[model samples]
Target: MMKEIEFTLNGTRTRTETQPGERLLDLLRERLGLTGTKEGCGIGSCGACTVILDGKAVNACLVPAQAVDGRELVTIEGIMQNESLHPIQDALIRHHAIQCGFCTPGLVMSAKALLDENPDPSRGEIQRAIAGNLCRCTGYEQVIEAIQDAAKGGKTQC
Candidate 1:
């Protein structure tokens, strides 16, 4: 059976019908057409399906679609504003932090969540924030640098 779900998606109010056990990643990619959230590990060990759920970074693959009802969700597709990329995204590109791009979205979301809570996070904090996200390429040095650069601005609205 499909149940009605209402939530805020990408800053807009949204309503949809989803099966009780449907994963949030499936709902975003299949139903809503937000494909930036990837599915590297169905078991949630990989952070490719990360998204901001109620201001925290979470693996969408591990979250039930119905569980997001009445909550605020932000995906990689929603991080930009008025044709401009988020600072974290721009920093990633400038720092060459994205390699192959498979894990960029999740890493970006994780960094965004950290910056949102603590604009000035230490290197260790940044590492811990994205520990769940595994990236075979880039080795995380560039990713960590980008997050640090984004923090210098002290803005994490996106």
Candidate 2:
């Protein structure tokens, strides 16, 4: 049976019908056409599918589509405004944190969630926030630097 679910996606109200046991990852990628959220590990061990759900970062693959009803979700695609990249994204690019670009979205979202809650987080705190996210390519040095730069108000000027 398909059930209707209403929620806020990327700051916009959205409604969709989800099949039983459908995951939010599939809903976002397949149904809603939001492919920025990637699925690396279907079991949630890898944070490639991370997204901000109601102000907290979560693995979209582990969340039931129906569970998101009346909630707010922010994917990497929604973090930008006016065709400009978010500060985290800018910092990541400036710091050369992206490699292969497969895990960038999840890292960005995790960093954003941390920054949203704590504007100025310590290096250790930033590390903790993104510990769940595994980036095999970058090794997290530049990624951590990018988050730090973003915390220091480093925004890329286009």
Candidate 2: C-alpha lDDT: 0.93
Superposed by TM-score, candidate 2 places the C-alpha of residue 21 at a distance from the truth, in angstroms, of 1.8
Best by TM-score: 2
Per-residue CA lDDT of model 1 for 67-156, tens digit only, reads 999999999999997999999998888888887999999999999999999999999999999999999988899888889988886243
lDDT of each: 0.93, 0.93
Q: Which pairs clash inside model 1?
A: none
Q: Taking the candidates one at a time, how many backbone clashes does each contain? A: 0, 0
- lDDT for 130 (candidate 1): 96
Residue 114 in candidate 1, Cα distance off native in Å: 0.3
Q: Which pairs clash in model 2?
A: none
> How close to the true structure is residue 92 of candidate 1, measured as C-alpha lDDT?
87
Off by over 4 Å in 1: 154-158
Runs with alpha carbons beyond 4 Å of true place in candidate 2: 155-158
